[model samples]
Target: MKLENYNVIGVMSGTSLDGVDLAHIQFRIKDKKWDFTILESETIPYDLTWVQTLKTAVDFSQIELEKLNQEYTSLLASIISDFITRHKIENLDAICSHGHTILHQPHNGFTLQIGNLPEIADLVQQTVVCDFRVQDVQLGGQGAPLVPIGDRILFPEYDYCMNLGGFSNVSFEENGTRIAFDISPVNTVLNFYANQFGFDYDDKGQISASGEINEALFNELNNLDFYQQNYPKSLGFEFVKETVLPIIESFEIDITDKMRTFTEHVALQIAQALPNKNGRLLITGGGAYNDFLIERIQFHLPSIQIIIPDNKILEFKEAIIFALLGVLKLRGEINVLSSVTGAETDHSSGNIYQPK
Candidate 1:
C-alpha cells in the first residue's frame, strides 16, 4: 500500500570521509505533492580504525571488501540503534541509507556502496530501502546526482541546486529538463591538503585565503579532461587519486600556494559549470561555509546569486533527500531521472527489505 505519511531515518556517508550522517525525517504527501521536515539529525565521526579501513578498502581484494562490507553493516546498525534509543524515536517506517561509496566507476558497469547488506533490515528491525544507484548504472546511466529528483520536488524555487561535499555537483533545469553533473573536487582535495598542515580542514578557507594562487597550476587544473566532458557524467575518488592528486603533487610550491591555487580551481570550475542564467543558485554542503571559495565563485560569476540555507539543511540536506527517495520508492513513483543520469528511462529505484 502507498503510504501518505512516513517517519523515516536517512543515512549518508559521503566520499569526503566526514563520517556518517543520520537524519530522522518525517515525510508527507498532500494534494499530489510531497513535503518533509527534519525532526532530528546527527553525524557520527568515524574512528581512526574505520576511517583507515574505508579509505583503503578500494585497494582490497574481493574477499577483503566483502568482509569489510559486513563489518560496516554492523557498525551502521549499531549507530542507527543508538540514534533511535537516544532520541526515543519511534514509529519509524523505514531506514533509508546511502551507505559509504567505496568504488563508483559506473562506466565500467559497476558501483559499490557498502553497508547496504540486507541484514541491516533484520538488525535494525525496521524496513530498509537502499542501494539506489545500481539499477540506474545497469541501465547505462551515470547513476549519480540522484539528489536532483529531490531538488526538483522539494526545493523547486532555485534556478540551480549546488552541493559542495567531497566534490561539487550542480543541478538546474534546462529547456524543461533537469540537468545536473559533478562540477569539480572541493573539500576532498582541500581537506587532504589541510591534513598535511595538522588541521582537519581549511577553516573558513583561511589557509587558502592566506596564500597566493599559482597561475601555472591554476591553468593546468582548468585544463583537466573532465572539464571538457558533457553532462550525464559523475566523479569518484578514483579520479582524484589518479588525476587530481598527481597533478597537484607535481608542483614544488608551498602548501599554502597549492591550497590557494586549488581553491581558485574549484571556484572557477563551479562558476563555469553553472548555466549562464540570472537567478539564484542554492549552495549547500560543507563548502558553503568556505568564505574564500565562495568569494572567488562570486567574483567569477557576479550575475548569479548564491544562497545558503540554515545549518540543519546545510549539513543534512543529502540525508533528508535520501529519506524522500525512500518514500518515493515505497510509493512506486519515479525518483531517478534518466534526463539527469542518462539512464534508459526514468524509474523508481531502491531495494526494499522487510525485517522478519
Candidate 2:
C-alpha cells in the first residue's frame, strides 16, 4: 500500500568527495500534494584511506571493485546506523541512498554506484531504496541530474535550479518539459588544484580571486565540445580526468591562474546556458559558498536573480531529493523524467530491499 507519510534517511556522496551527507526527512501528502521537512542533517567526512580508494575506484579491476563495493557498503551501513542512533530516529519507512558513484559512462551503456548492496538493509535494519540510475540508463538516458524531479516538486517557484557540486548542472522547465544538463566541471576541477596546495578546497574561491584569468586558457576551455552539446547531456569524472584536467594541466600557469581561468570559464558557460531574461536561478551545493565564483556568475548574468538558499538546503539538497525519489518510488510514481535525461519514458527507478 502507498504511504501518506514517511520518515526517511537520505544519503549522498558527491564526486567532489566532500563527504557522505545524511538527512532525516519527514515527507507527507498534504491536501493531495507532497511536502517535506528536513528534521536533521550531517556530513560525515571520509578518512584519507577511503578518499584514496574512491578517487581511484575507476581504475580497479572487476574483482577489486567488487571487494571495494562490499567494503563501502559496510562503511555506509555504519554511517547510517550512527546517524539514526545519534538522532534517536525511529520508525523510518526507508533509507534512500545515492550510493557513491564510481563509474558513470552512460553512453558506453554502464554506470556503477557502490555502497548500494542489498545487505545494507540488513545491516542498517531498515528498508533501503538505492542504485537509482542503472534503470534509467538501461532505458537509454543520461541517468543524471535526477534531483530535478525534486526541484520541480519542492521548489516550483524557481525558474531554474542549479547545483555546483563536482560539476555545475542546471534544470528548468522549457516548453512544458523539464530540461536539465551539466554545464561544466566545478569542485572536481577546483578541488584538484586545491589539493596541490595541501587544501581540500579553495575556501570560498579566495585562491581563484587571488589569481588572474588567462584569456587564452579561458577561450580554449569555453570551446570544449561538451559546452556545445545540447541538453539532456551529463558529465562524468572520466570526462574530467581525460578531457578537462589535461587541458588545464597543459597550460603553463600557476595553480591560482588556472583556478581563475577555469572559474571564468564556468561563469561564462553558465551564463551562456541560461535564457537571457529575468528569472530566478536557485543555486546550491558547495560552490554556493564560493563568494568569488558566485560574484562572477552574477556579473555575467546581471539581469537574472540568483538565489542561494540557507546552509542546510545548500549542502543537503541532493540528499534531500534522493529521499524524495525514494518516496515517489514507494508510491509507484515517476521519479526519473525522460524530458530531463532523454530516457525512453518517465519511470520510477530504484532497487528496493527489505530488511533481512
Candidate 3:
C-alpha cells in the first residue's frame, strides 16, 4: 500500500487504569476530508504488578522514573509488535500512542508521558508519534482532554461528547467556540475502592447499587473548589490524592456507601458540564458500562439525551482519537485546541520518531 493509503495503529492507556487499548485503523483523506475504519482493536489488561507501579509512579524519584520510562517504552513496543504479528498486519503507515500519563501538573511548567522512547519506533520498525501534550502544556495549556479536537473533527454531529473514563470530561461547543473540561474523577476513585474488595472494578456497579448514599460525603465532593473553577481546567492523580481522597476519608462511611455517593458525585458533575440543556450527549468510555452510574447521571440530568454508542466505541474511543490526532499532526493541522486546553494557540502537536 502507498504511504497515504497505509494503515495506522493508535494506542491509548486511560486513567481508568484499566489497560492499554490498541486500535488498528485505516485512515485516509479524500476531497479534503478525513475518514477511518477500525480494522482491529484489543485491550491488553495490566498485570497486578504493573498496575501498582503505574498507580504510584507519580511519586517516584527522578532516577527511578527515568528508568521506569525506558522500561515502559520497551513494554509498549513489545506489545505493539505482538499485536501486529498476531493479527498478521501488513502495510503499517505508523503507530501513534497516547502513552500512559505519569505527571500532568502543567501549571508548574512540566508534564510527562512515558513510553515515547525512540526504542519503540526501533522495535516496531514503523513511524511513531507520541507525547502529544507536553508541547501544548509548555505553551500554557492544560495538557488534557485532547480528545475534543478529535471529537470536533470526527464526531461533530452530537451536541456534546461526554467521556466517563477514569475521569469524567465533557466536550461541547458554546457561542460557536469549542470547550471542554474535566468534571471529576470517575473510575479512578471507584476502582480504588473496588480493589479493597479484591475485584478490578465494580461490574455493572453492583456494589454501588447495593449501597446507600452518604449525603454528607456526597455534598463534600460536590463542594470541591475545582468544581467552581472555570472551563479549560483538567485533573490529575494528584487531585484525587489531595482533594478527593482526603474529603472521602474524613467521612465514616462504608466502602459500598462511599462508592455509591461518589458515583452520584461523578454523575452530577458530568451532568453539569453539558452545554446544551436539551441536546443529545454521546457518552463513551469504560464508565458507560456502569449501569448504576449511568442511571444516577440520567436521573440527575433528565433533560439531556444520553446516547451510548457501540461497545467498540465505548472501549476504544481514546485510542481511536489518538489515531486522529496523529493524522492531524501528520497533516500539520491543529490537533490541540487552544479553547479547550487554554494554550497560547491552537496547533498541531506530537513528535514523530522514525525507525532507525
Candidate 4:
C-alpha cells in the first residue's frame, strides 16, 4: 500500500451551540494503520445573537432557512479563514465541517446542516468537505453519530467510545461490524436547566448535586420512547425542544430538582445503553466535566471503568475525527457506517468542493 498524509482543519458546531470548533490536524496512514496529531485548536463561542438565531432556527420557514443558510455559509467561511490565518497554517488539504444541524428528523426523511455551501471553498481559498449527514438520511438512516467511524479508526483500544455532547452516543465494535447509536440527551437538557439558574452550564454538576431528584420526573424521563428504541437511532435538538422540555415543564418541580432528576435520568439511560459491564469506556465531550454526573453514571455501573483523556482530546476529539472523515472522503473510502446509522450500506458520505 502507498503511504499518504493529509493536513486539514476540522470544523464542527454541535447542537449545544457552544461554539464552532476548529482543529488543525496532521493525519497519516503507516503500515495500513491511521495516526493523527492535533496541532492547533480553538473553539469560537457563538455570540448571543448567533446562539439565539440557531436556537430558534427549527421553527424557521423554508425561505427563511434558505436565507439563513447563505448567511451561515459566509459566517463559516470567515471563521475557518481566520483560524487558518491565526495559526499560520499554509500547508492544508481541505476543511471538514459538521455544520450545525438546524433540523434532523431522519424518521421523516430529512436533515439539514447549514454552513456547507460550495462558496465556502472559494471564500476560504481551500477545498472543503462537508454536509456529511444528508446522504445517510437519504439512504434510510438516522444520519447522525457520524463520529463513531472515527472512534473505530482513531481510538479503538477502548471497548466503547462515548460522547456526552448535546446528546449522548456510544459506538463499539460488535462481531465484525461497528455498532453505534445515540443514547440520550445530555448537555442539551442539562445546560438548558443550568441556564435557568443563571449559569452557562451546571459546573461540576453542582446544581444537580444540591437538589433532590424528583422520582416521578425521573421515571418519566427514563421511560421516554426514544430510550426504548434500539441501535441506529439518533436524538436531535428537535427531540429536546419538542418532547423533552415539555415533559419536564409539565411538572411544578423546583429548577434544581428538575436538574437533579434529569441528571439521574441521563445516568440511568447511559448505563442501560451499554452492552458490556466490564471494559474500559472512553468518555469525552463537555459533559465529562460534570463530576456529579460522572459519579452517578459510575454509581450505576461500577464494573465498567470510564477513562477521561487529556483536555485536548476531550475537547477536540470530534473536530479531529471530522478531519479524518475528510481524509477518507478525499481517498474515496467509507466514513459513515451502515451499522451505526442503519443505512442501506456503508458508504463514503460527504460533498467535496474545490476552490474555484
Residue 84 shift from truth in candidate 1, angstroms = 0.7
Q: Compare the candidates by lDDT and give the number of the best one.
A: 2
User: TM-score, each model?
Assistant: 0.98, 0.98, 0.97, 0.99
Where is the poorest 10-residue window by lDDT in model 4? 1-10
Expressed as tens digits, the lDDT of each residue in 1-356 for candidate 2 is 56788999999999999899999999988776788899999999999999999998889999999999999999999999999999999999999999999999999888999999999999999999999999999999999979999999998999999999999999999888888888899999999999999999999999999999899889989889988888889999999999999998999999999999999999999999986556999999999999999999999998989999999999999999999999888888999999989999999999999986
Misplaced by over 4 Å in model 3 are 1-6
- For 17-130, candidate 1 gives per-residue lDDT tens digits of 888999999988888787888899999999978877887887889999899999999999999999999999998989999999999998899999999999999999999999
Q: Model 3: which ten-residue window has the lowest total lDDT?
A: 1-10
Query: What are the per-residue Cα lDDT tens digits for candidate 4 across 62-89?
Result: 9999999999999999999999998899
Model 1 residue pairs with clashes:
none
TM-score of predicted structure 1:
0.98
As a whole number from 0 to 100, the lDDT of residue 260 in candidate 1 is 97
Q: Tens-digit lDDT track for model 3 on 152-265?
A: 877889999989888989898888889988999999999999999999999999999989989889888898889999988999998998789888888887999999989888
